[model samples]
Target: MADDTGNLELEAFRAEARAWLEANFPPALKGKGGLAMAEITFQDADLATWRRAIGEKGWATPTWPKEYGGGGLSRAQARVLQQEMGRIGAFNPLMFGMGVTMIGPTILDYGTEAQKQQHIPPIVRGEVQWCVGYSEPNAGSDLASLQMRCEDAGDHWQINGSKIWTSGAQYSDWCGALVRTDPTAKKHDGISFILIDMHQPAIETRPIKLIAGASPFCETFFTDATAPKDAILGELNRGWTVGKRLLQHERASQTGDRGPGGGGSAVALADLAKRYAGADAAGRIADPDLRTRVIRQQMDAKVHGLTLARAAAEAKEGASNAASVLKNSATHVAQTRAELMLEIMGHQGLGWDGEDFTREELEAVRGWLSGKAMSIYGGSFEIQNNIISKRILGLPDSTGST
Candidate 1:
């Protein structure tokens, strides 16, 4: 009886969601969710309007609390909202921001009431862009070895040093960073997480263009930058813990926690193969080997989706170690698809730009090129393997420490 009642209530919510989305989601933006970028999120009038609409409705973060300007929907209802949004090809305009994916959730996890009041509302409203400061030139995977320094000032905190591969720093209004707060302590123990304003003169960002063309990554230097004393997240010298927690959030978002249909309008593998490689008499891919490989790729994708769904259902209010496992899996599925796509497109996939190829084909070439970084970013494949073995499987670290 309870289950039946819940189902009835969810059905009512679904109907309500359908109506509300139909009225509020702009027709011009339908099926165009993949087109919005944080740098230009507000550049187009229609896209800005769509962002404001969804942010205000708080459906951009459906399962978050209402107090923080979130929709306050239950997990079940959030799923329903996603289903309705997917029904019309509507995407979360704000999901592209690292604020929503990594920093905001970490704030909610470890922030004080005052900090939450200061930050989460702006995030939920899509009012600011955020970047992360973790990787240093010397400390890519050994992030704990990062030397970016933070110190106590009489009235404020002083920040110095730099971050490399700081994604979206040029456009970000703020940064959530891991810094060395206690230099005398162990590398992992001396870290502190803090929030910094990007607008100050002490900070400068230089963009790093990748082979894929325009990129969001930058080398961000902080020369005696400043933050309020309260800007430190969690306890002083306890940021390694906080930073790991944030990584879990990062991995989860990378694994598609951005809600249903949040992956954008990416063409399916089978469809792409059928279109590019031609088809057999029975409608399989024309090439027998390609057909089998495509089927396997599709199956792998399906397994990742199912695993992700199950994990999401079982996950609690913050992230967990399981995210590490799923992140690698997601990377595998995505990279495999990109490889298959390029092979199926043959020389046609080699298009850089010209009238000879379609926009999707051009993007496919770039995607295939950029896809190589998947195993490197968001923690490397080896890093994730270490995490899985040590944390999940209770294996020992290289130092013979558990």
Candidate 2:
């Protein structure tokens, strides 16, 4: 799949990629498999092998610059690689998290050449994991109001604050966090984006349990957690701008638009429907009204996916604001799919946990509950609507009902 002479057609690249993945990626790893297949775990050795293969080829981050240990492929070629990988049912080598979704993009766009050279390669090779430290207990939607203080010293900064809803922090090696660097300035003015070493003795993470019984998120406490002077991501006291851009990338990834491979809720939903609602179950499609709704949702998902592709293509050509629309559409699609899945399962979807419940039933309930956050996180639905109106439609801000 290497574009050696810079003239290889996408079709040829895809053919080569498909053959390579088929030959290498285990068949069991492909597609949405059954319960047993889903239960199959990839250990450290397995993950290392996959990461090394993809990292060596720079295929893990194909569109990234070659100097940063990326494939240096064009967007078109990257799409070909994704399609071929999907064709062979190859799971993405890099695990999804704040690292790939948020921090990596921020570093790429705003970091100095030296910072990029140091950070991007390790991330591309899965050598480290990262988390975002944005949402404090009091400052989620109003992120500018964060109170995490990073006091300046001679060589480093002393960070002290609590960050809530930090996903994967317990497992992360580092965090791309927002801290108040200048208390004298306005809420948005004093903040700086800094990379915190999670392994520090002063840093602590306590898992926060959710309604779904999973605690992937954490409450992180930084008590004089020190970050080197070089750890600052962008201009000092101008981190909000960099942070917002990173959030944009984070939102895009959550919506399944940005990142190494495109995101989709359809495959997961369809699999659930097939398993819980059965191939031709009455609840699945017998009701014309429900069937119409499902078809509409499926069409909408496809449209959203295509819209994301279009936006990404435009971005590659230097367009701005395409991400806003794509993010809005993708989040809505995901929320709808979650609701539809629950509806399709009906009474069976109500179970929380028990041996009596099948895996499909458990998934339906957990997914339905978790899906509620889709619109809220990554900028709330109201915020997205505001962006669309002001930025896309050129409408004035209004409190009045449409």
Candidate 3:
């Protein structure tokens, strides 16, 4: 049942959104979405056109504030826009960046007015790429142990040390990094979150090749890489709190609750199984066990979606730490799909590159390899469970215990 005026206005908005998408989004990219991180060829005319169109329209960050070049839509309106885009198979080109997923949100939460004016517009425009510099060679999972020094240098802060597993560091224009600012303070207390330009001479990036065909990960070194004195995000030596918030944003992005489709694939799982593994006499999947697993995964994905929607409805502003729950669920669903896709594709999935395997199959294998890291990234599965146990479950902390 639909109300007269409100329903009509919503319908009108949807129609307008659909028309804009149809006019602007390239036909080739409709179902394909934005280029996958590894496959991003920024020079492609179609991609460039689509990215520019959405960025300028401010639809790239639909729920963000308009002053920062965001779409200025309410949460409901943003959801509608996403639905309209999804209806047409259109994908947001700018959603892939750390800027969109992590940095920008943190900036909005804690940045000074001047900082927002300087950074948010470019981010909203998709004009820059950002990498997170959180993991150091020594820090890794124990991020608070980071030793990247940021020294006071009057006009700028001199940074020194290295970050490992920095995704997109080589291609990034900027980095939102966690650095140690005060050695005398507590491990988590003395840290600061800073924004550093990646194009400077003091910063260097080396790509780290993975077992997967493409490498988005990098080793980023800072030898006196400087951030402007005012570039420290949040209060000086209070980055641990800021960093945690950023992680929440990161987890939220991974859970797919914020944007279109909850990051789920357009192609249904059963369809893939039927296509690759073939069907039985009754037109059901031939493999009984695989069919069961696929059904369960589908159900789990649905449950995860419902839970996310519920969480969204409950939270008036910021999300709860329960994003960690969704993150773990998403990891499970994705890894399960990868495993099933490989099984269904069988030998076709094994080839890295050849005439024998379809592009989709090759991608599946690579995606499987890449998806394996999802558990490790955005806080590992174990870490998320720990969060769930303590934060969500109210379990006792086992620190300094056997």
The C-alpha stretches of model 1 lying farther than 4 A from their native spots are 38-42, 316-319, 396-402
Q: Give candidate 3 regions above 4 Å deviation.
A: 1-4, 34-36, 39-42, 261-265, 400-402
lDDT of 3 by residue, 324-397 (tens): 99999989888988898888888888989888888777778888998899989989999999999998999999
Give the poorly placed runs of model 2, Cα more than 4 Å off.
Answer: 1-8, 32-48, 258-284, 316-319, 354-356, 399-402
Cα lDDT listed for each candidate: 0.87, 0.75, 0.86
* True-structure RMSD for candidate 1: 2.0
Clashing pairs in 3: none
Clashing pairs in 2: none
Put down candidate 1 lDDT per residue, 38-139, tens digits, no spaces.
335346777788789889988888888899999999989999998888888888888878988899999999999999999999999899999999999999
Whole-model alpha-carbon lDDT for candidate 3:
0.86
lDDT by residue for model 2 over 117-202, one digit each (tens)? Answer: 88898987767878889999999888898999999888988999999999888888989999999999998899999988899889
What's the residue-level lDDT of 92 in candidate 3?
A: 78
Full-model lDDT, candidate 1: 0.87
Ranking by TM-score: 3, 1, 2
Candidate number achieving the greatest TM-score relative to the actual structure: 3
Pick out the ten consecutive residues of candidate 3 with the lowest summed lDDT.
33-42
